[model samples]
Target: MSAIRFDDVWKEYGDHIVLERVTMEVEPRAFIALVGPSGCGKTTLLRMLLGEEQPSRGQILVDGKPLLAEPDADRGVVFQRYSVFPHLTVLQNVMLGREFRDAKFSARLFGAARRAAAADEAMKLLAEVGLAGQESKYPSALSGGMQQRLALAQAIMRGPKILLLDEPFGALDPGIRADIHVLMKRLWNETHLTVVMVTHDLSEAFGLATRVIALERSRNRPEERERYGATVSRDLEIFPRRRAELRSSVQPAPAGTTRSGKEHQPGRPGALVLKEQP
Candidate 1:
């Protein structure tokens, strides 16, 4: 389990401030969605959570441990673009992280048995992400949605404590994006993996998050910085725990299945069931 806490964090690139005095806490196994307009530091917050960037001021802690010096296995990240290697098969690409992180072998003599086990694990994750029977395919052969699924499977193959997604489904069609959302929700329920996703889509945020955080720019002038600072909105909305029926209602049925079990229903938009909570 991982609990994340950001205390008065400030992030800057040279002289440009990305995040200012941003503070929040993410409970263990909590699905937190960071939503905002462009250039509001949502991705920067994800980077800090992933330990890829350090805050210019204040601190962030994960599971009671500081984030700046944590190891890679503690956090898994999936970006909007496909991060798979074109040269390798899907199984091979998924196993790369485990092979480097845990294997003790020379490239000249990588053990067959070890690699096979790793492949099996990767295959299982691929199946979970709806990529079954595609393990032998190369990255170039898959659709954009399938590639993102592969990337996600690769990220979670090692079971990181925290999963960071930065607009991972942004490039996919609406139908595919909705399918990914269902997959993500199922994964979260099954594994209870703490997730922090940065998304520009308000509907996606509202659909997937246990709590949503909205970030905005400060409007305080320099003279009034201390006296009358502009307060950015940080609205938090927790959705009610979704039952299987609720999830099933919105879940896209298996490929080739139809409303009548014979003919497929084309252009059926996936429903997103979001039960709002305080």
Candidate 2:
């Protein structure tokens, strides 16, 4: 289990102010959905948590320790664009998940025994994500929903302590979204990982998350918008908080050594994680 805290966080880009005084605490294995307007720094907050960007005036802590400057094995992410390599086959894409955490700086092919082990793991995840028959295909050949599934498979392959999703399912159609939502629920229920998601879909947020957080500027006049950055306007906790039940639903997969025996330092955005997107 892992917990996240944002203490007096602020972010700025030159003359533009995005978020201000954003403070919140996330309990272990909680599913949080962040919703806000387009330029309100919803994704910016996520990037900061992912270590892609830093808080201008405050800090983010994961399981008590401060977040690193770069993403580590403890955090994994899934982007809306399906953060998978278009060039690699579906199987190779999943293999990168294991290799990325192992290599960190660079993830490439492994030796025979290691490659076989990784392949087995990747295939299991692929089957779980319903991509068993598509292993030999490329990302370009799969539909949008299938690609996103592949992205999730890679992210889960790493066994992240915190899973950060940035509009991960916004691109899929209604039918596909519904199906993926079920898949998402299954993943969360089975893994019991702390997940934070950014989305514009309230129904989606309400449907899956244990908590829903809204951020927007109180004063949005043309002149006052920049002066007043967005803050958490509302935070709604889903009824019947089942976190304790979730912990017992499935055994937490050990990613790495736990800190203080209670906090798990499990594992990065499930980013074929080390290449430029085409």
- Best TM-score among the predictions, by candidate number: 2
Q: What is the lDDT of every predicted structure here? A: 0.72, 0.82
TM-score of each: 0.79, 0.86
Per-residue accuracy of model 1 over 1-278 as CA lDDT, tens digit each:
46677888887777566678776656556678888777677887888787778888889987556785544887888898857889989988888888777755743226888777777778778888999899899999999999998988887886787889999988889999999999888877666367889898889988988778887777546654333321235656453643222234234433322212222123321112212223
Residue range 45-65, candidate 2, lDDT tens digits: 999999999899989988678
Q: Using lDDT as the measure, which candidate wins? A: 2
Q: How accurate is candidate 2 locally (lDDT)?
A: 0.82
Error of 2 at 247 (Å): 8.0
Please give the range of 10 consecutive residues that has the lowest summed lDDT in model 1: 268-277
